[model samples]
Target chain A: MPYVTVKMLPGRTVEQKRALIEKVTDAVSETTNAPKENITVFIEEMDATHYGQAGVMHADKK
Target chain B: MPYVTVKMLPGRTVEQKRALIEKVTDAVSETTNAPKENITVFIEEMDATHYGQAGVMHADKK
Candidate 1:
């Protein structure tokens, strides 16, 4: 089973999120030979401040 | 920044992994209005035994 967690910025249409989940699940299923029903994809929306790179938060990275 | 983590069964080619990352990044960027560099997608491969649902481990779930 694949528990795919996608953490991105907030603000996505429900359709978009759903589509992403479907596509991601399909990709994993195809590659891993796992059944589609066995895949669990989780979408986590986070504030830019929660992420950092090179000692700089994502809100400040760019 | 989006820290997208894709956790699935092990056994994918480097090329496949790279492609998944790129595609996921693009999807997030286009939908979230976040810059590509700000998206950090992490791929984690887990044994089916590690994941469970309905109180059953994935290795045994399906």
Candidate 2:
């Protein structure tokens, strides 16, 4: 089983998420040939305060 | 270093999350021998509509 986690900013609509899961499942299945049912995708959303880049928190950006 | 993520339904308080992160980090470190700072832990929450089990969406359950 292949477990994939997509971490990004919050605020996507349900439609976007639905499409994302489907497309991502397809992509991973195509590349790895893992069964759709066997592959699990988890979406993680992080607010600016919790996410950091280059030692700077996203919330601290101007 | 090990990258671990805990995926579950939403509604956990910040204190619970803080404890979860700490304990999970310690467990991973003890088993894998990875340093604390080098380990990255992500908490992903899913709504009923977005999560499914046994071919049924969590939202569809009674």
Candidate 3:
């Protein structure tokens, strides 16, 4: 089973998330040839304070 | 390039999370031979309603 996870900031609306899951499922299915039903998708929403990049926290960005 | 994610229910203490990341990083390093610095660990906390098993939501389980 190919489990796909989308990790990003936490402000998307429900409709956006719905579209994201559908589109991601289709893309992964097309590339990996896995059935849509068998592909699991997990959305991880991270707060700015909890995420860091290039040795700096997102919350500290100016 | 080895990215490990630990997905579980919420409520672990900060010390527990610290130990978890350390132990998991070490284990992955030992198994995959990836350097400790090259490994990235993400912790995902899921509510019972957001997770399901065997076609049943975790929140619905008794």
Worst 10 residues of 3 chain B by lDDT: B13-22
Candidate 2 residue lDDT tens string, A25-56: 78888898887778766666789899888999
Q: For residues A11-37, what per-residue lDDT tens digits would candidate 1 score against the true structure?
A: 788988887787767766665567889
Misplaced by over 4 Å in model 2 are: B1-6, B10-45, B49-62
Q: Candidate 3 clashing pairs?
A: none
Give the proportion of true interface contacts each model preserves, from 0 to 1: 0.52, 0.02, 0.00
Using all chains and alpha carbons, the TM-scores for the candidates as numbered come to 0.66, 0.58, 0.53
C-alpha lDDT score of every prediction, in listed order: 0.75, 0.76, 0.76
Question: What lDDT score goes with residue B43 in model 2?
Answer: 92
Q: How accurate is candidate 3 locally (lDDT)?
A: 0.76
Where in model 3 is the C-alpha error above 4 Å?
A1-44, A47-62
What DockQ does each prediction reach against the true complex? 0.47, 0.16, 0.10
**Tens-place lDDT digits, model 3, residues B1-62:** 67776778887776566667667778888898888777766667899999999999998996
Model 2: lDDT of residue A55: 100
Best by TM-score: 1
